[model samples]
Target: MEKITPKVDIAFKKIFGVEENKDLLIDLINATVAPEDQVVEVTILNPYNPKSFSNDKLSILDIKAVGQTGKRFNIEIQITDESDYDKRALYYWAKLYTEQLKVSQNYATLNKAIGIHILNFISITDSKKYHNVFHITEKESGLPYFTDLELHTIELSKFSKD
Candidate 1:
């Protein structure tokens, strides 16, 4: 029998965004995020629910979780190459990062937010690397200004079974 591809957005969300698959999600996050930013465990903040999208047609099935260290993780799978994919990803990342703070909460209380994008097509065509990580840094010094925000992109088209 053929296996269903988890690369599909719904399938991806269903597999990694469930409470029962918490361990699997944690392992996946640890493998995807930077070594220094790895997490021991993660709690599914927004667990997958098919009914949740039944009313909204524009909703993207992305997995949202919070790590033991308080860092937030958003995982998304894209099979089609949208024109404004980069901007859309950044918008989602920024939304998640900023939404951590309440009206009276301090900025320091905000936790690191990471967005991981698994793309079936080559989003970054300039590079052949399957895995890429982005961080805010000083241009001349090449030093990270703040490690609070991170974005990871995995090009499935560049992946090989070998």
Candidate 2:
């Protein structure tokens, strides 16, 4: 057996390096979330297959994450901006949320589902914010419609050097 000691760097990219630490994703999940119910239950969504999506689809380079605590997280590094990105994100977000409801499951049984996008290219929107979070909300009263479904996106292009 061999033991290896590595140097440390001060950056989120260092902690969550993309090329390696694929499995460490689970660790990130474990750290970011804490559930009130059973902590024994945990699952990591892996959508790395090019064929997992449609035949000609660009394919998901990797997955964000979903937790048993009804929390979802997505961390992606994208270099290009595709058309209808807003719709695309929504489509995937809905897919993650609805996929949980099987043949005989109630709505309450559904856990929190989230999608996170790390875009390397500038988004079409004019907003200068670095991050965005989406949640169900009422139209009139402006109250959260539900806390179970969540979406988060981080724009790396806007990341500044201060």
Task: Give me the candidate number with maximum lDDT.
Answer: 1
Where does the lowest 10-residue lDDT sum fall in candidate 1? 48-57
lDDT of 2 at 148: 69
Candidate 2 local lDDT, residue 37: 22
**True lDDT of residue 15, candidate 1:** 84
Candidate 2 per-residue C-alpha lDDT over 82-105 given as tens digits, one digit per residue, 9 for 90 to 100: 877777777667666666677888
Q: What's the true lDDT of residue 53 in model 2?
A: 48
Worst 10 residues of 2 by lDDT: 3-12
Model 2: residue 36 alpha-carbon error in angstroms: 9.9
What C-alpha lDDT do the candidate models reach, one value each? 0.83, 0.57
lDDT tens per residue, model 1, 1-162: 988899876778778888888788888998998787798888887533223245742334388888888899888889999998998888778767876887899999999999999999999988889999999999999999888879999999999888
The most accurate candidate by TM-score is 1
User: Cα RMSD (Å) between model 2 and the true structure?
Assistant: 7.1
